[model samples]
Target chain A: MKVKTVAEYVASGEKPEILFWVGCAGSFDARAKKVSIAFAKILSSVGISFAILGNEESCTGDPARRAGNEFLFQMSAIQNIETLNSYEVQKIVTTCPHCFNTLKNEYPKIGGKYEVLHHTQLIQSLIEEGKLKIEGGAFAGKRVTYHDSCYLGRVNGEYEAPRAILNELDATFIEMDENKTRGLCCGAGGAQMFKEDEPGDKRINVQRVEQAMKTQPDVIAANCPFCITMLMDGLKAKEKQDDVMVCDISELIVQSNGL
Target chain B: MTIAQIIFILLTIAVFTVAFRQFKRVVDNIKLGKSEDIAGDSVQRWQNVALVAFGQKKMFKRFIPAILHFFIYAAFLMTQVELIEIFIDGFFGVHRFFADKLGVLYTMIIGFIEILSVLAFVSTLVFLWRRNILKVPRFIKPEMNGWPKLDGNLILYGEILLLIGIFSMNGADVVLQKLDPAHYPDTGTLPVSSWLGPALFGGLGEGALHMVERFGWWLHILVVFGFILYLPYSKHLHIFFAFPNVYFSKLKSRGEMENMPEIMNEVKSMMGLIEDTGDMSDDIPEFGSRDIRDLSWKTILEAYTCTECGRCTSECPANITGKKLSPRKIMMDIRDRAEEVGTKIRSGNPEYIAEDKKEAGATLTIDNFDDGKSLFDYITNEELYACTTCNACVEACPVMISPVEPILEMRRYDILTNSQGPSDWLPMFNSMENGGAVWQLPDERGAWTKEIEA
Candidate 1:
C-alpha cells in the first residue's frame, strides 16, 4: 500500500486528518497484521484522510514501563513524542488498546499530548456521523461476543465503543459474564505476552477462554491486537479453533461493510 | 502509700517508658525511607480508614475468620476500659473506682465485658485450631515457620491468658467482697465469674481469698504490661498501624502506575522543555528501588502495618500458579530487612554508621551503601518477573498495602541499575530502544496495510 507518511503529507502542503498508529503487534504479528489490514480497508473505504508514521514510528513503551524499566520506557516515549511533535500530529487512532492507553493517559505526563482513540471508537464515531454505512452484509445474524481488553475497559472506562460497532453490524450480540470492567485479563498484559508463562496449574488465557465458551458464540470479537493474539491462542489450545472464529472488531466491521 | 503500692507504680512506669522508646525507634527507622507525599483527598482517606481498618471490610471476604477476628478485636478494645480501671486502682490504692460513681452502669459494663472476654477466649481457641489442627494453607506457608509461627501462637496464648486473668480476678474479688464486706465492697457484676467464685474458692479462708484476689489482680496487670512491650516486635503491631496506614494509602485508581520524576525530567530535557542542567556527575541516578532505603516512607510504613495474614498471597495470580512469588513474603522480607538495617544502625555497626554519615550531604550510589545484601539477596529474580503487575494484592490488603509498588521498583533497579533481568526481556528492550517497537524493525509497521491495498 502506498500509505502516505505525515512528513510526506506536510511536504506536499497538505495535512492528514488523523494519524493511524500501527502498533508492533499490528505491524508484525501475522494474525494481527490482518486486523491492521481490515482497519486500513475500513478507513480507506470511508475516505478518511489518515496518514501513518511509517518507518518513523516506534513502540509507545507501554511494555517497557510495565516490565519495570522506566529508563527504556522514557527513551522510547521521548523518541516517538519528538517525531509526533515535529509533525504537530493532533488526533491519533490505534488498533491496540495498550498503545491507545499509554498515548492517551501516560503521554500527557511526559509531554506527548493528543486526542487518542481506539479503532473501535473511531469506527463507532464514523458510523454515527453517517460517514460510513454498515448494511449488515456478512455479519448479519452472526452470533458474536466482544472480549473487553483490560487497558480499554478497566483502565480507561471504554466499555461501549466496541459494543456500539457490533450493534451497528446487526449481529446477534452475546456478552461474556466477565465483560467490561470486570473482565479477566487475556494473560498477555503487563509484558507477560513476551515471556514464558509463570508456574501455575492453569494458564490465565485458558481460564478466560473457558469463560468465553460458556456464551457459545460463533465469533469472539476483540478490539485490541494483544487480546486477539491471546484469545486466538486460547482457542487453539482448547482445539476450538475450527468451531469458533477469533476476530478483531475492525475485521468484523470491514466484513459487515463488505469493504 | 504502702511499699507494695509504690513498687507496682514504679513497675508500670518502667514498662510504659520502654514501650514508648521502642515505638519511637521504629518511627525513626521508617523515616529513613525517601519521603513521598501521600497527602491529598482527606475525605477519601478517612473513608478508606473507616471502611478497611475499623470496619474490617476486606477481612470479611471470608466468613468464619472475619467473625472470629471481629470477636477478638472488639473484645480487646472493650477490655481497655478494664485496663484503665486497673491503672487507676493500682495508682490511687482505690478498689472499684468507677463502681461508686457509675452505679448500675458500671455493673452493666462489667457484665458486657465478662461476656466479651468469654467470646474472645473462644475465638482464640478457634484460631489455635485453625493454625495447628486445620492447618489453613495461607497461615502455614513456608515463610510462616520459626519465629513467625511461634509469634502467632504466642499472641493467641497471650489473649487467652489475659482473658483468664480478668475472669479469675473478678471471681476472687467476688469471693473477697462476700467474706470481708467492710474492706471489699460488693459493687460490680460478674455474671460468668460469680458462679465460679463460690464453686472454686468457697472453702478458702478470708486471708486466702485476699491472697488469691491480689495474685489474680497482679497477673492481669503484669500480662497487660508485657503485651505492650512485646507488640513492637510482633505482627500484632498491625492493631496499632492499620488505621494510619489506610489513611495514608494511595487513593488513585489501582491501575495507575506512578511515573518516576527522575526519568520524566530526563525526557523533558530531551524534548527541550527545560534547560539541560549539566550538573550530572559520575553517580548515575538510580531509576528504581534497589533496597529498603530506596522505597518511599509510606511503603516502609506498609511493611510495619502488614498483619502477615497472607490474604494477598492467597489472591495473587503468581502464587496461585505455583510461582515463587508470594506478596505476603514480599512484605515480610521488606519488614525484616528494614528491622535488620534499623538494628544495625542502633548497634553502631560500622557499615551502617558510614552510610549514615554519607547521608549528611555526600553523593554516593544508594545501592553501594547496603550491607553486602540487597533486596535481591532475599527476593529472587524469578519471583520479581513472575508478577503480572496485577493490583489484586493491593485490593486484598485489609490495611491498603501495595506490595506491587516495591516489586515494580525492585524490577526497575534490576533492569536499570544492575543491568540484569530475565534473559527473555533483552531482545524486547533492544527492539524498543532501537526501533521503538518490540519487533526487529520500525519500517515493518505498515507492511500489513499493503495486503489490503493490493
Candidate 2:
C-alpha cells in the first residue's frame, strides 16, 4: 500500500513490519541519527519490528516558512506529503523540536497528519512496558540537568517523559530556572538555525546555555538537535567547554545501555 | 518686527529646523534597518488586556504614573484656553477684562480642563516622590529616578508649582468673575469656578475678593508665560514627542517570515574573486558572526527607541529562565551607543562599529570602521547567541521596535565568518548536508511514520 501524509499512511491497505517516516530533523543530524538508531535497536531488542525510511525524507521546511519565505515552505510541505504518502509510511519519531513542531502543528494546516513522539517519549513508553531497562547511572560527582527542548516541552506538552528518563538515571537532575512550561528558547527555533541572525539581544543560545549552567550541572542534557547544537556553541563560546558538557539526553541513556 | 512676532517667528524657525533634522535622521536610521533587529520574539506572550495596555485609558494598573501622566498629558491638551488668554495678554496687554465679551465662558471651560490637568499634575508629583524620595521599584525608571542628578524635591516642586499656578489662575478667575458679575455673568454655571467664586470671594469684606482677584490674576499670567517658555527643556518633552512617536511608529508590513538567504552568506571567497564587502549574506563561507561590528544597523535603532517599558523583559523566556539577556536592555544599549555617536556623525566615533560608523567628512558621511569598544562590551557573544528568536518582544513593543532581526543576522555572520559557535553545529551542518534532517539519515527515525501506517 502507498500513502503520503500520516492520514493517508495510517489508512493505507498494507503496513510494513513498522512504518518508518524519517522526520526532517530526525533524518538530517548525526547525533539525532545516533539516537534514532539507538531507539530502533532498543525497540528491536524488545521484539518490536520496524523499518527506517530514508530516500524520500527531506526538510520539513520549517526554516523557510519562519524566515518569511512562505512560498518555498509550502512547496516543501506539499512535496513532503506527496513523497511520504507514496511510501506508505507513518508514525514518526523526531529528534529535533523544530521539526517536531512543524510536523505536528504546521503539517495539519497543510493537510498532513500523523502520530509523532520525541525519541525519549517512545523510549520511556518502552521502558514503562518493561521492554527497556536502565543499567545503572555509574557516572558520579555529576550534577546533571536536562534542557527541555521547546517542541517536546512547550509545544507538544511532553514535560514528564524526558524528565522521567533523566530521573531514572539516578544522576543529579536539577531544573533550570525556566524549565518545562516556560523553558527558555534554544535560539535555534523559527528556522534560525538556517539563516543569519541580526545582532540585537544576546545570542539566544548562549543565554539558554548559561541558564543551563546556572544549574551548575556537570552535564547539560537535551532532547533536540537544535538545542544541543546551540547549547554546545554557547558552552564553547563561554570557554566552559571543559567544565560543562552538552550531550543528547539519549546519548547518556545509550551509554548506560551497555550498547 | 514687534518683539512678540520676532520671538515667535525665530523660535518657530529654530523648532522647524530641529524637527526637520530629527525626521531626516530617523529616516536614515530606518534605511539602515537599525531598529527592532532581533531574530525572534517568543517572550512577549501575554494576550491583549482589551483597551487597557494599548489604550492606557485607565491608569490604575500603574497608579502613580497613571495619575501623574494623566494630569501632565491632560494639561498639555486642556490648557489651550489658558494659552489663548496668555496670547491675548501678550499681544494686547490685557490680561482679563479686554476680551470681556468671551472671557467668562472661555475662562470656565479652561477652568474645568485645568482642574483635570491639576489632578494629573498633582499625581505626577506624587509619582516623582515615590520614585525618588521613596525609591519605589516600578516597571520603569520614573522621571526623578531616571536622572539621579535631578533633585526630586526640585522636580516635585516644579510640578507642584505648575499645579499651583493652575489653581491660582482658577482661583483668581473666581475673584474676577464675581467682582465684575455683569461682564462675566455666566461664570456661575461652571463646576469649579462657580463654587470657588463664592468661597475665595464670598465671605471677605463686601468687595475684598476684587482686590485679591487682581493680585492672583497677575501672578497667574506670569506663571502661564513661564510654562510656555519651559516646554522644550523640561522632561515633559514627552508631552510633544509621544504623540509624534505613536504616529510615526514602524509597523510590521508582512506576516510570513522574510526570505532567509539561501545559504548563510560568506564574507570571503576561496578564490581571489570574492569580495568581503560585508555582504557576507551570500551562499558561500559557512555562518560567521565575526565581531560586534557585524551587527545590522536596524538592531542599533531597536536599541535606541527602547522606552525601558520592561514589557519585553517581563515576556522573555530566557529572562524567566534566569538568563542575563533582556530585549529591553538590548535596545537601551544600542540606543545609548547610537546617541554617543550621533553628534559627530560626520567625524565618526572610534567606539562605534563598522555598520553604522559615521565618516570623518560630510556628504557621504558614513564609514565602515568602528574599533568596537565601550558600547561593544554590553553585548556579549553569549548573550547574543542566547536569544530564542521568539516573536514575544516584537508583540510587546508598544513602539513597534522589532528587536529580533539584527540578532539573527549577527548569528549568521558568526556562523559564516567566524566559524566559531558550538562545535556540535558542525556535525549538525554536515548532517543537514547529507540527510536533509537533524536526525540520523538512514536510521529508523521514521518508524513513527511507519507505525502510523501500520
Candidate 3:
C-alpha cells in the first residue's frame, strides 16, 4: 500500500490527474481514516493518477463560515486557495460532502475554482465509464439503507450518485422514510459536530437513525464522514450498534471489490 | 341617477383609496431594507412565477391539501368575472346586467362561477376543520398560538362569509326573476344558486326577495373591500405578494449563500493579497442584519410574502427535534420588526431616506425612530445557533422563501459584528485559525497517509 503526495508527484516532473482532498475528518478522525484509505485504494486500483495534498491540504472553512466566523473562514479559504493554485490543481475529489460543497460552490467567489466531485459521484462515474468493477465481495445479499447527507443531497442536488453506487451491489437496498430531498439532517451539519446539542429533546441523528431502523437495515450507508460518524453514534445511543452498522459508501465499495 | 348608484360609486372610490394607501405602505416598508442587485434572468424568474405562483407547483407535493387549495384558488380567480358584473350593475343601477346582453354565454359563465363558489365553500370548511377540529401539528405549534391562530381561523371564516354572500345574492336573484318578471332579468337558472335559492327563501314574497338580493349584494361587496384592507395587516397578503415574490426568486442553488464582497475585499487587503480600494470615509456597512434596515429588500419582501403556513418550521430539523429555531418564526419576526420600524419611520418623517444616503446628522432615517430595538429582541441567540443551515426550510417553502439566509445573516452579526457565539465553538474556531482544521491536531492532517505509505 503506497500513497503519493502532490509534492512527490511534482518533484518527479509529473502531475497527477486528480487531487484527492482528504478533508479534516478523513485525515484525523480514526474511524474516518478507514474511509480515506478505502477511497484511495479504489482510486489506485482503478489505475487513476491521483495524489493527496499531504501536509499542504487545509480545511475548506465550511464549518467556520457556517458557524458565522467569516474572518476565520476567509483566512483559511485564502490560504487553501493559494496552496491549490500554486500547485495548479485543476480537479479535486473529496470523501466529505462539506469539503466537496465548499470547494465546488463557495470557492469560486474567493478565487479558488476547480472541478470538484464527491467520492460517491466519482465512483458512480467510474462505474459508468467501465473503469471500475464492484463484485459484491462483502455484504452480498444484505439489507442496506443509505442516509442522505444534507450537504450532498439538498445542498448540492446529488442524491442519485450514492444510491447509484448501491444499485451496483448485489444487496437488497432499502430507503429510509426520510431520504433524498426530504432527508433529515444527521445532527452534524452547520458546525454542529464540533459543539454540544443546543438543548433539544431529541438529537437529530437519533431521529434520523430511527428512520433507518424502521427500514430494518443490516447496514446504514452514508457518503459523508460527518454523517457516518453521527449515525454510528446514533446506533450506539440506541444500543443497536451490534445489530446495525454504519459504513461510508467508499468503504462499502472497497469491501465489495475486496481491495 | 338613483341614490343607490351615487352611494355605490362613492363607496367604491373610498375603498380603492384606502386599499391603495395600505398597499403603498407595505411597499415603502419593504424599501426600508438595504438595496440588493437581484435584476437579470428575467426569463427564468417569469417561469418561476408561472409555475410556482400561477401554477401552484410546490403545493402539489401534498396531494390532499393541494387539491383542496386549488379549488379555492381557482374559485378566487373565476369569481372575478362575477365581480365585474356586480360592479357594472351597481354603478348603472340595473339588475342582472349581463343576463340579457350575453344571453346563454352569460348563463354559462355565472353557472361556472356558482359551481366554483360551492367548491370554495367546501374547501374553506375543510381548511377550518384541519386547523380547529383535526388540529394539525404544524398549525398548533407554539408560534401558532394566540393572534396567529385567531388570524388563521378568521381568514377562513371570512372566506365562508364571502361564499355565503355569493350564494344568497344569486339565489335571491333566481326567486325575483320568477316572482317579478317585469324588473328582474332572467339569469336562465344558475346551476348552484337556482336550486339553493328557492330552498332557502321560497317562503318570501316579491318585496322581501328584492330586499334580500340587495342585502346579499352589499354584504359581498363590503366583505371584499374589508379583505383588501385587512390583507396588509394579516398573513393573507401572500395572495398578492406571492406573484412578485416567486418572480424574483433567488436563481442560485440553495447551498450558495450570498458572498459578502465587502468582507472578501477587506480580508484580501489585510492579507496583503490586494491593494485596499475601500473608501475610508464611507461608514462601513453592518456585517450582517441587526435590524430590518440591515437586511436586503428581497428578504423583507419574503417576510411579507410568507403565509405563516408553518411548512418551513415543520420541515426544520431543529424545530422538529425540540430546538427553539422555528424558520416560520424567523420570517414572522422579520415582518413584525419591519412593520414596527416602518411605522415609526413613516410617522416621524414621511420622506425618510436610508442611512447610507442621508447626509451626516440628517436624523431623517429609520435609525432615529426604531426605539433602539433590533431583530435580536424578537429572535434570540439560542434560536439562531440552533439552525443547521440544512436548507430544508427553503426547499419546503411553496413560495420560494429562504429563511436560512436571514438566519445566516443574523449568525454573521452575532459572530463577526458582536463577537458573540456559542461558547463550545471557540476551540473549533481557534483550531481553524491556527491549524486550518476544526480540531487541535495541527500536524496530524496527513497522518493517515503513513499507514498507506508504510
Candidate 4:
C-alpha cells in the first residue's frame, strides 16, 4: 500500500517505461479512479506496465492557491513536493488537467519539478510509438463529442490528445457549438467542487451538458475528472442520463478492449 | 386654454415631480457615505457629463447593441429641449416656430435615430431572452429577475412612443402646410414625414387631423419625461449610472485591495481594516469586504447603474457550471443591498458602521464574509469559492463595474486569516509543495511547457 511518487512509479518496473501519477481528482474521486484503473488495465493487457503514484498522495494545492489561501496552499505544496523528491522521480503522467496545469505553471514557484503527461497524451504517444496499436471499437457508429476540460484544453493546451484516443476508439467526435479554448467552464472548476453552488436559474453544468447534447453525441467523453463529474451531473439534471453517457477519455480508450 | 395647452401644463407637473423625487433621493444618499467623493466640483461640467454618459465607453465592449444604444441615447438626451420647444410651440405658440429651424432639424435626426433604437431595443431583448430560452448557463445561473428586468420592455415602449410622437408632429406640420399653404413653408429635407401632414389634412377631417397632432405632441412629451423620472426605480437606471460608473472606474490596482495596511504587525493596527490612503500591501490584514461602504464607491455605483443587462450572468464561469452562483446575481445583490443600506445612510441614520469599525481588536465586517466560518454571508460559501476570478464578467460589462474585484477582495480576506479555501485548492498546493508541481516533481512542470507549442 506504499503508493510510489512519480519517480518511484517511473522506476518501479522495467517492463514498460510509462508512469501515471493518478491525479488527486483521479485518485480521490470515484469516476477518475475508474478511468485510471481502466486505462491501467488496458495498458496491462497490451504488455505495458505503469503505476499510480498517488495511492499515498495528498490533495494538490491548485484549489487553495487559486482561491487566494496562501497559508494552507504553500503548506500542501511543500508536502507533495517532498513526497515526490523522496522517490527520486524523473517522469510522471496524470489524467487531471489541473494536475497537469499545476505541475506546468505553478510547481517551479515552490521548487518541485517533474515531466508530466496527461493519460490521453501518453496513450496517443504510445500508439504512435508502435507500442500500442489502434485496435477497434465496433462502435455502434454513434457519434460522440469530446468535452475539453479547461485545465487540459485552455490552461495547458491538451486539446487534441483526448480526441485522438477517442478516434482510436472508433467514435466520431462532432464539435460542440462551444469547443476547445473558447469552450465554456464545466462549473466544477475554480474550487467550485468543494462549496455548495447558489440556487440560480439553471445549473452551469447542465448548460455544458446541454451544449454537448445539442451535438447529439451518443456519449460525452472528457479528459479531466471534474468534467466527467460535471457532465454526468448535467446529464442527470437533464434526465438524459439514459440517452447521453459521460465517460473519461481513458474509459473510451479502454472500451476498445471489449471490441 | 387650448386642449393642447392644458395637456402640456398637466404633463409638465407629473414629470417634474418624479424627476424631483428621484434626483433628490440621489443627492441625499450620496450625502451620507463616508467614502471620499470621486467626482467633485468638476463633475458638473457639461462636456464631461456628456462624454462619460453618452460615449458609452463601458457599454461599447458588447459591440453591436452598444453602438445602436449610443445613437438612441444620444437622440434621447441631446434632443431634449427640441422636444421642449415642440411642446411650447406645438401648442402654446410662445416660442415662435419660424425662429427654431434647428429644433426642426434636431427632431428629424432623433426621429431617424429612433428607428434604429427600436431595432436595438428588440435585438437586445431577443439576445437576453435567447440566453434564457437556450438556458445559456452563464446567463441564468446566478440570480435572474432580481432587478425587475425593465430595460427591454420599457425601452421598446419609449421608442415606440417617440416614433408615434415624431411622426404625428411632423404629420401635423404637413397638415399645417395644407391648411395654410401660403403661410407655412415646407423645409423639403424631412422627406419621410414631409408629405404626411399635407396628405392627412387633404383626406381626413380637418378638425380630427388637428386633434391628432395635438395628441401626438402631448403623448410624446409626457412619455419622454415619465421615462426620465421612472429611470431611478428601474434597472434602466443604468441609463444614468453607467456614465459615472465608468469615469470613476477602478483602474486595475497592484494586486492589492485599497485601505489595507502596509504592515500588519505594526503597533495598534486594527486587523482587517484601514483608512483609504490608496497604498496596499500583503502585510496588511484585510477583513471581508463586509458591507456596502467597504466596497469602492464605483462598486456601489455599479449596483445602482446596472441595466440588469444579464451580460455578467451570461459570462459567469460558476453559473455555467451548475453552481448556484451567478455573477449577475452578485451585482444585483450588491445593487439591492446598497440601495437598501444607502437609503438608510442618506436619511442620516446613526446606526451606520464602516468595515473600519473596531471590535475586539478586529474590524467589524458586515452581512458579508463570516460571522463564524466561511466567506460571504449574502452568497453561499460554495458560490463564493466557485468564482474562478476569470474576469469574464468584468471584461464583458458594458458598464465597467469590474465585478471580479469585490469578489477577490473577499477571497483575500478569507485567504489571509481564516485558512479557508476551496477543497480542491489544497490538493493542488500539496502537489506543488511536495512534488513542486500539480503533477508532482516526478511529473515535472517544465515538460508540458516544452511539449505544448504556443
* Candidate models: Cα lDDT each: 0.83, 0.56, 0.89, 0.61
Candidate 4, residues B146-165, lDDT tens digits: the string is 33533445655677677677
DockQ of each: 0.41, 0.11, 0.78, 0.13
Task: Find the candidate with the highest DockQ and give its number.
Answer: 3
Better of 2 and 3 by lDDT: 3
Lowest lDDT sum, 10 consecutive residues, model 2 chain B, at B264-273
Cα lDDT tens digits, model 3, A1-259, are: 7788899999999999999999999999989999999999999999999999987888899998999888888888888998999999999999999999999999999999999999999999999999998985487669999999999999999999899999899889999888887899998988989888888899999999889999999999998899988999999999999999899988888888888
Rank candidates, lDDT, best first: 3, 1, 4, 2
Write the residue-wise lDDT of candidate 2 on A141-256 in tens digits: 57889887766675566789888888878687899887775577777775557545544446767778878878888899888877777888899889998998787776777677
Give the docking tier of candidate 1: acceptable
lDDT of 3 by residue, B377-418 (tens): 999988998988888998899999999899999999999889
* Ranking of predictions according to TM-score: 3, 1, 4, 2
What C-alpha lDDT, on a 0 to 100 scale, does residue B399 get in candidate 2? 48
**TM-score for each model:** 0.82, 0.55, 0.96, 0.58
Task: Name the DockQ score for candidate 2.
Answer: 0.11
In Å, residue B334's CA in model 4 sits off its true spot by 0.6
- Per-residue error for A201 in candidate 1, Å, reads 5.3
lDDT of 2 by residue, B1-454 (tens): 4675455445546655765666556445434433333333223212222232334442343465665665665665666666675556545544454345676766566657767765766677676666557755324332214542253344455556655555555565565555565643333355565676566556665346545554455455545444444433233333343333333433322122333332211211222224544653453543322332334454444454454556567667556555666776666565544543444454554443354434455233334534444343656655565566565566455545566655555555555455545454445455544555543445543444343234
Which candidate's TM-score is highest? 3
Worst 10 residues of 1 chain B by lDDT: B361-370
For TM-score, candidate 2 versus 4, the one ahead is 4
Q: Please give, as one word, the docking class of candidate 4.
A: incorrect
TM-score of 1: 0.82
